[model samples]
Target: MKHNNKYERPKIVKQVDGLMNKVGRPALNKPFDKIDNVPVDELISNFGSPLFVFSERTIRNRLNDAKNTFTIRYPDTVFAWSYKTNYLDAILSIMHQEGSLAEVVSEMEYEKARRLGVPGNKIIYNGPCKTRASLERALKEGALIQMDHLDEIAEVEEIAKSMDVKPSVSLRINLDAGIYPQWNRFGFNLESGMAIHAVKRIVLGGILKLTGIHCHIGTFILDPLAYKRAVEKIIAFEKELESKFNLKLTVLNMGGGFASSNTLMNQYLPGDQAAPSFAQYADAITAPLLSVQNSYSRKLILETGRAIIDDAGYLIATVIGTKRLVSGYKSIVIDAGLNLLITALWYKLQILPAQTYKGVVEDTVVYGPLCMNIDCMRDAIPLPDLQKGDKVVIKPVGAYCVTQSWQFIKLRPAVVLIGADGSVDLIRRAETLDDIISAEILPERFKS
Candidate 1:
């Protein structure tokens, strides 16, 4: 092995934000080195590094765990795979196999679900923006469309007037759930009576049937008490709707904002230890809901994206180089970055070496290959000493990363799925220049 011992780290003494200026060997001796008993070397040899690998067994098990937790408590729970979370066809297939309905926000996603053979009724269409054509198609296909604004109601009403069938509609409500940076932009506010008024217009219009209610409090909710409080407000709103309009809700979509085992940057404890279990969330949601049962006993709907999938996904990348930072800290560059692992911005992503070595571990900063200084995967974490071409796994990336990933300085890589039978499948092929340039059209005036 070639040693990079060129620059001696400058010695400095400083302290900030409770961190002491200290340089020493890493305290931990062990490194997490495998996935599903498959050695990291085998995965890299077959799929190549800088790859996204998912465990089919993990997905199935998580979905089953969430489903069982809720259904065992309330008995009428339905899990809708949040499309924007990780909508790869194989992932959705796994979700659907575990009996998840498609919960989509836009026309493209709605159409994608339709193409995937998800029945219209099984799809919950929710978002602030829905074109008239999507509303018409959703209506004709018998989808459950949740009204986010009164204008949407009017558009759907207009479409219903021309058609012979009434559109099945629900209302997305916003309320003060005692959470910071409240999400009030998407739905009508319950405190302001906007939500109630929207529902009233739909019920009075006679052109649409108000059949469901929805409220997505926010994302990465660590406290189950926040959900408990949100559920109370939703239940109260449901009663108010029923009492005033005589409209019964057939579906209550408690929009999924469940936290996964990926630790937030601000979090002090590991996610597996700090975040509440599915059982706790189940209890918080279903306990209050079970107390009341009307003729239209609502089908409890959950659209969790991260909790069921994050821990199941892992990104394996090859270390390009290691350097000693000016502060005498170690820095390791990996082949993956914010382009493929955007969650690194707010998540303290767990990264581990592919092979084990015990001594001389140190505090390491993981960086991406991008020329930009901001292309870092982790800030400061204790990692085993690594060399060029060594592999590391950044995990709990099963949700949001792929859906929100964009190519920048480097080409995107392939995504491989490890099946329950330990069979490896290349779900997404690595992007190439041809793939990126397929849509390019040189202007006739500029073409040489």
Candidate 2:
């Protein structure tokens, strides 16, 4: 990777009253003293290196921030927890406790939602692929099954034919948000008139009842106008559906793409640097929807995954080694790898030395303890001096990191939830060798 030679990190000075340093970036006040008292050191010593910690306060605050934004503007709003974002039971349960319904895409997610005590009626099932059994089961359970394609529609129709009751359905619409190469695979095309055709088929098909129209333009959207435009186009189609077919739309699901605070490496500033907060997203989505006039008022449903969880999660790792390159620059390697925190490989995350920021900054690279050359955390980071055995904290990773982690060459790390009272408890135990090999059995003659 080529480093940006023109880039310069500002010299930061802390103020007693406020958080900004000379760099204007919000400096993180070291919480190690408070954190250390919680037995994190004991847990790490017992559980080993590379730990994942979640703050219950952050999760509740972020969720309330997102929920309050929409509730202030729109009368009828429902926030569905996007299960694929971070599906840890503790995380999902926290969201559920905060009144979020489940937004699932697959059978596993649907079952997970069921396990979490979310009634089937509260679950919104979306995705391109669905098995016949899955569709039948979702139908039987009265979950909101979103139609992805004609084949899925046929599958649902076949099951509905044998069942005693008809199924409730929603059609996923693909809109040209005037951005991207266009997403045509997951949903029916709105501009090409395919979506209208599908709606008519579902209305006339007799096996399924169309309850809503759903649209998801894109993911990690930086511009608020993109959502405004998408909402306008979506409402226009809702109008056409109502006028043309006399259908009363019950819900309009503008699917999740709200960008999290983790900035992409290619981005000029970090995602938290200029990325819109949860309130901004809520406003961008609901404003256009509320402006539209409808015969039957529609409930605005949001399947937000990343923005809800990203700020609440933190990955804590210990510095395992330090090295000086042939070019005489310092580098730090940690025990955590891309196998556990995939976002670190893509997002140039802001790394802070937990207890030690000695005001000395250097251009550095952070690497993970992986054999692959590609398993790097940050290529060229201007960070404070770090020593081996010192702790480092990477923030705003409460979103897709845990859900997307891979077990490539290492076991995943344990996840601990820090409560409001400052007590810590293990939510997920770190993987064990027996846990890994329990599913496998060797024949006596073929044992290695």
Candidate 3:
């Protein structure tokens, strides 16, 4: 008989009633070697480790599914890509190609959309702080400015008078959607009669046209019933606007808060199981709009961001070293940190080994290379034994990671887009030392 010589680490097992021990369960040893049919090793070799990868196919498919799901029921549904979600030029270009319009929240974002060749009429300008110059520019360029407060109505009227342009605007109304922690900071409150008051003020002023009503309840909302309540309230308001002021609203903007398939830190179930599907949300939102009595045709705008782009993005990090903690638990340090993957602060992101591994499964804490103690990625996860120079893949990061990433202890890495045809293209290059200090100014007095 041949003697087996495989080495395995010794670990004490604690048995609990009605709970299967991880030691007796199958190990998560399956290798995640490829992304969109492209090998992970080849990507790291070409773009270097700690890279961001996006799948073009995944984005298109998700967007198409969302469009079809909503349009099939509403028919007048329009998708305005939320720039703040993931505003890469390539990502925006893809959205534009798919017939989506631009939804911007700041002057910089509005300018970026313009530079990308998106027409002014196609842009939906939204936010609380719209500078005087930017508001004037948006008015002149035909952007749909969604007013957030009563003061903004007067400001828009002033800008309209100066530019001699009759800008059709939208009002963002916040209401009680049966959800906790209501987002009443940005827009007028509907339940308190503030929304109706604002509408009357705008209609009576006659300087700006109130052609639309918008509402954004909250972010990452898991309950579809919240949207139903918001829509019902919006329809009631529309009825009041038409009956009292004879103002017929042509647009209904339901600002996006659809949850993405990324598990929240305190969630009881995984994201895929907890997050509501696009179909479920569509069913909840469209039912109320369809029940309205008015015969006037209205365009419904959805400003979804994370749901369409989150799962399409990925992060590949290389393991720098591994160590055993003082408590006998294992830990591994990767090249990527909180700077690159800030969403890790709220999301329990999924991490998988880039290559195959076989050994004892242990609870490991994945940490970033940053010297800060808060650079921990995964606090405790059951993972196979990982060694130095190994690679790991963190996923569903395609939404806010790239835009929110900053230069902290390490420079940001290159980002690549994998096309449907399996061709890879570099969307963003890695940061260099010169890139970081190019805008700095030094005084001659400080020079040696």
Comparing 1 with 3 on lDDT, the higher-scoring candidate is 3
Instruction: Give Cα-based local distance difference scores for all models.
Output: 0.85, 0.81, 0.91
Candidate 3 per-residue lDDT over residues 382-407, each given as its tens digit: 77789999998898899889999999
**Index of the highest-lDDT prediction:** 3
* Global CA lDDT computed for model 2: 0.81
- The estimated TM-scores of all candidates read 0.93, 0.90, 0.94
Pairwise TM-score winner, candidates 1 and 2: 1
Candidate order by decreasing TM-score: 3, 1, 2
Model 1, span 165-266: residue lDDT tens: 776677888888888899999879989888877887887888988888888999988888888888888888888887998877788888998899888889
Positional deviation of residue 235's Cα in model 3 after best superposition, in angstroms: 0.7
Arrange candidates by lDDT, descending: 3, 1, 2
Q: Any idea how many clashes model 2 has?
A: 2
TM-score pick, better of 1 and 3: 3
Task: Please count the clashing residue pairs in each candidate, in the order shown.
Answer: 0, 2, 0
